[model samples]
Target: MDFREYQRRARETDQTPDTDGDGLIVPLLGMAGEVGTLLADYKKRLRDRDTYRLFKESIAEELGDILWYVANLATKLDLDLDDIAAFNLRKTRERWLHVGEKQGRLPFYLLFDEQFPPEEQLPRKFSVKFSQEKQGSGATVVLTWDGQTIGNRLTDNAYVDDGYRFHDVFHLSYAALLGWSPVTRKLMQRKRKSNPKVDEVEDGGRAGVTEEGISAYVFSYAKDHSFLRNVGALDYELLRTIKRLTASFEVNIRSPADWERAILAGYQVWRKMRESEGGTVHLDLVNRTIAYSSE
Candidate 1:
């Protein structure tokens, strides 16, 4: 059955209050609780080998509960499950494919080079502002850069309240310093103009994986630096969440003296993956050139 049909059936059985005005709280809490239960089931199986026989069924039940809550939450928020799934897949495909196909491998040295102009040459110190503004029936986080409105989204309030908003800013700093943004932008433009389908699948996939690697680097840096205590917004939960997400990857940010090194590590991750797929990318930032080859 499709997501829309599942959502429709799930709503019929939902016993939660229809107009109690709990907003996103009920489903949010329910989802969290279900996830905890799912984890606990795995923990039990790990501790006792005899439980292996029941593991599959037990896990399936927990997943169903999780799905029910997720669907209900989407319904309450007026979001379609199919749309969410499609958007997520599209976004992931676009990001990773594009970067890998068009700009997978680069001059290794460029990743280490510091491309950020000196402070004297900088237009202004990098800064961001976060605030809440009424959006629809609830409030959303409004993000601004250099006193100009950039964008806003209905993010988990916990991110703002817990001071995890700096997470993206950290990644942004790395991108600017290493000049990856310009390179990625140019690659994207060229690929999109040449063939939109190729851009979406291959180019986008490369960009997606590159971003994941960058996130891994940023998390490693934050973990080593105590989440940059000087910022005074360090949230242990946020740090833990990031660590858990990137734990599967072996990548780590190695250069403490230069942030550019960390950014390069992120790029190397995508390049390595592309290499395994028989793709090669050679980039020269100074010369403003890119070459792609498939073996």
Candidate 2:
């Protein structure tokens, strides 16, 4: 049955039918109790594995019971199950698919430098050669493009090696996915110099440092989560913090999924870069992708 019809019929069965006050407590307790039962059933399935022939039937039964409790709770809370379900699905799609996302000529689709010369625009497609060299007790990365060093050599700067030297891939991912990266623009001499205001505010030092801060912040968070290895999604708060950090900048307009994809793509390339010590990072803004190749 449809959620609305099912909800109405289900309400008829609520032991603690919605009353003027506090009568919803029984359904709340029942819902919590059903969750425990669901977990116990799942544990049984995991423990028994292939031999648990009744696992499917039991899981379906438990889930049905839980759904009834959920509908009961929703009714007691004066909410519609269908409306809640629809709202949640829309939010999930927007976060996962980045609904209304678009692509354009300039990074982040901002027209700040669309009229600028090629030399002053972030290269839509290019490769940055990566090489690791020993420096003091720790190793550092030397990034070069067309045989010349680009950015200052980078290192983890921490007591241990966590591959932060290769963090530039994240910036490259931003350039590719969002068409925005102050760090990448500076490193490639792609700063929009035609307009002094744009140069100072959009492609200037503070923006570059802010981009670096974004990288470092996400790195610390990802480190605690195994560098986001096998992670399918990012924490909503993390994405929100990233937006807040960039709120004063042009990239503040990017969606959560945009940031999520960029972060994950960077880590995907990062794993390969870390394995090979260093590798060439490829950026393609048209297709919005960043990839790695061993040098």
Candidate 3:
């Protein structure tokens, strides 16, 4: 049966009244409670091997309860279950299929359709440099990219002794792909004044963090592809640090191959948003420049 038809029939069984704004609340609570019951059943199955006999049946029943609450909630929100399902599938397909096909290819080739240029063919080497200055009881760390000062962080003796560093070149590549550079951010800010909602749907709500996460994924891919080595010897901590920092974002970074797939996935997401919402930023790695456009 069609999902809409199922939703219609399901709505018929929703006897909850609209009184006291409890219609949504009822289903929301039901969903939470049903999920808890489902978890409990799984826990029991894990604890008791004999429970495996009934686990499938129990799971099916709990899932049905969860579906009922979901349908009810959709009804309360005036949303169609079929529409939600369709939208989710469309989003996933758009963001994965094309990019997934490009796995195993060099990132520059996958992203810009150009071969990975030899080091001598490139204009200049990319590097993130750091300097330290002694303060009262500590030192302030200053970071620079291509001789342009970028950021500063105050650090204690121990922190400086640790020789920690931040990698920005990989992130620059990601920012170039997603148009999340300082210039892009400024443009977005200006656009927000005229159309506040533009920023809401574009850039995934947190462009900086999103770029960092994608960049980390690409860094992993680059490392395995030998792109990092091609450029120069890199600090072993670069990928480790990026992975640690972006872990909070819940990005999947299982293996080198997975990271390449993830980069494509991330590119598709930002590309779709840009195509629909109207903004463009292209990175010219050779010239080390970013060109921006907006509609």
Give TM-scores for every candidate, taking all chains together and pairing residue i with residue i. Answer: 0.39, 0.68, 0.45
Among all windows of 10 consecutive residues in model 3, the one with the lowest summed lDDT is 111-120
Best by TM-score: 2
- lDDT: the better of candidates 2 and 3: 2
**For residue 183, what is the lDDT in candidate 1?**
25
TM-score for candidate 1, residues paired by index: 0.39
Q: Find the 10 residues in a row with the least total lDDT in model 1.
A: 249-258
Q: What RMSD, rounded to one decimal, does every model reach?
A: 18.4, 5.6, 13.8
Q: How does candidate 2 score on lDDT?
A: 0.84
Q: Residues 1-295, candidate 3: write the lDDT tens digits.
A: 8888888888888878563377878888898998999999889888997847899998999898888888778877888999998987864553344443356432333222123233212222243343556667554555444456655452533533322222333344343332223323332222233334433433234645565454555545554654333343234344345445545432322222333333443344333322333233344544434333342
The TM-score between candidate 3 and the true structure equals 0.45
Clash tally, candidates in order: 21, 1, 0
Best by lDDT: 2
> Residues 155-229, candidate 1, lDDT per residue (tens digit)?
434523322322333333444443333223332232233446534543355554655455655555555654443
Tens digits of per-residue lDDT, candidate 2, 189-212, equal 888888898899999998999898
TM-score sort, best first: 2, 3, 1
